[model samples]
Target chain A: MERLAFELESAGPPAPRAPPVVVGVVASGNLEVLVEPGDLAGRCRVEVATSANGFAEIWDAVLRDFAARNAVAGLALSVNDAGATPAVVSLRLDQAVEEYLGQRP
Target chain B: MTPGNPGHLPARRSYREATARRRLAGILDPGSFTELLGPSERVTSPHLAGLGLAVAFDDGVVVGRGLLGGRVVLAASQEGGFMGGAVGEVHGAKLVGLLRRAERERPAGVLLLLDSGGVRLQEANAGLVAVSEIMRALLGARAAGVPVVGLIGGGWGCFGGMGIVARCCDALAMSEEGRLGISGPDVIEATKGVEELDAADRALVWRTYGGKHRYLLGEADLLVEDDLAAFRDAAAALLASPRSLDEGALAREHERLARRLADFGGCTDAADVWRAAAVPDPDRLPLLDADAFRRAVAAARGEEP
Candidate 1:
């Protein structure tokens, strides 16, 4: 397993009422994401513990893109991945944030 | 899958397809589920990390307390998506703790949503020990007047040591798709060869260990639809009337088993057992739906259909 951590700048923090949210499951080619409130003022911290190794650069790219798309400031995202592809990672990240903001469809 | 939906939907929502959290939400009262060791806690498997395997945040089982029809109850749902919901040290410990709590707290009931392939092969010894501990804890809770009901309808049918644990419950409800058995089909075929039991024969597999056959054999108290609402209603109904584990009950159970052995021990297949049970045209039984099948079984037993 490989561990990766990143902090990215955000536009603003989410609503204060947004409680901790978790989405997805840790299955083969799938992952689970947990989003919680963090102390960061204008940044979001993302940590990943994945079964697939040698993908730090890919993780960085995905996390950066997620931060760019959402205002996830003052939030921490933790991912437990089991060889999920980049597309699945992006989808789970969006789902985690959307669920945190009570916007799950 | 909103938390406060009340779950009276027109469409059939499959319990077998839902995640652990979703299943708990579907059964519990709206907005009443309070997870004890939630995902944010990061209580993952310590052994999986060392083995270079992905570890889940809640260790593949979701344990929590919730309200069922205004009564407080505890529930534990196994996440079959994670390592086939196998019982590891932490996963089994969480369930053990919940059952022990049920003994002390004496909740309305304990719901064990079992969907496991038995012990985790990676954490072999720890997983086996955990299954034993869970069984003891579950029986202990029952002896303390705490009703523990096992529900089986997960993607991975209950097998191995967990099958014994399921039978230890005060009551059990299984969907037609659910299965309860000691050795799984794959395991049997792997050890005894395909001629002994073809794991690829889905029809044979289901007939041998599926909920329908188990229910007909009086192994499951209730055979329900695969829908979540069906499971929820069955659990509620079972919590109202739990089986006693007293000396008389044990004696009766022993007698029942002995009689069964004498009557149908020579049966080679489920069809043969069904024939011995006085089900006319046993080959056609599987084609019937759940309600029709129940009626047929009742007729075979000389009960009102």
Candidate 2:
């Protein structure tokens, strides 16, 4: 297995603009995402670097869907993936938001 | 092999013979393990290759999905014979990734068979950060109601950041052959003088750093024989137990460690704490098999060792 890595950082405020928090961790076959508003810019930016070479397209789809859906501004999302299934990757991404930015469990 | 028999890990051999692929076979379940980044991955350290040292595939850590008692558990074990089981950036990432999977699947448990000297000095900065990240993931798993168990079975033991990681686990199972501490004996000896820990004095090293001492002090929860079968059983029993630790238990763990530091006060003689804990014959205690020792000591204290 290749060490497929993908990372994304965005500037500006969420669609509604809110507080900032940092979340995420990188491990084999999984990822921990941290999403919190910061002083980047008005537009959201995402970056992804992975050890897995051929999965970039899959990551693009997932992150694109997330950005389009959330549209939260000024927030940064950093991902360190170790070959996670697309579903698991997205779950952690969504959970990272819930943990650091979203409602309390 | 079982209690009556044994295996010589870190046995004198070539890298292929001393590899974790062979070691983990006996550690985890039979025919249930699927390597995540097996030898074929070739995930060697780009940084280490620059330093001209040999780098193994899987970044020196063997990670996979396996079962203990058929309870589908995520597993990662260090290769002690390889570069003292140090954690590099990719090595650390692999671990956090598995922890993420554990959080997602709520695997019956996650077992990290720790065997490291600490962060790799060659890639020191990233390695240090990675250890901290792994710690956060460990905490997250606990919060998510999944058990994170650290098993110290390697001959090299664990130290530095890895030592802290081992302590943060919900439970730790250790063999007497393993040692856990922030700094290793050689480092301490180099600075504090061999008179302190005496890196060459095998007895003193074991007494100061061995798993038996950790067990008696409650630093290690379950003490098992120095064989794969014993270690495997402890993992299975924990899976069968109620998943997460109750608050009361965590509280007691804190109290025990604090009391130990307060009372022991940086003493070099570990037997002091053992005797104070009412362990009979602290000197001979290290030689006893894990089960016999537990029956003798933990039974008297009415606490899990």
Using TM-score as the measure, the top candidate is 1
Looking at model 2, residue A28 earns an lDDT score of 52
| Residue B267 C-alpha lDDT in model 2 | 60
DockQ of candidate 2 (2 decimals): 0.02
Listed in order, the DockQ scores are: 0.88, 0.02
Write one digit per residue (lDDT tens) for candidate 2, span B1-305.
Answer: 34545773433322122336555666577767788865434576888767644455567687888877767888888876656789999889999889988889898888888889999999999999999999999888878888888888677789999999998788888878888999999999999986667799888888788888888777787887666767777777765653355798778867867887897776658887777677777777877877778877866587675
Interface RMSD of each: 0.7, 12.0
Model 2 chain B weakest 10-residue run by lDDT: B10-19
Q: How well is each residue in B1-305 modelled by candidate 1, as lDDT tens digits?
A: 35678765558888999999999999899889999988878888889988989999999999999999999999999999999999999999999999999999999999999999999999999999999999999999999998999999998989998999999998889987899999999999999999999999999999999998999888899988899889999999999998899999999999999998898899999999999999878898888877788888998999987
Model 2: per-residue Cα lDDT at residue A32: 40
Per-residue lDDT for B197 in model 2? 71
True contacts kept of each: 0.94, 0.00
Using Cα atoms with residue i matched to residue i, what is each candidate's TM-score against the true structure?
0.95, 0.67
Candidate 1 residue pairs in clash (backbone atoms < 3 Å): none
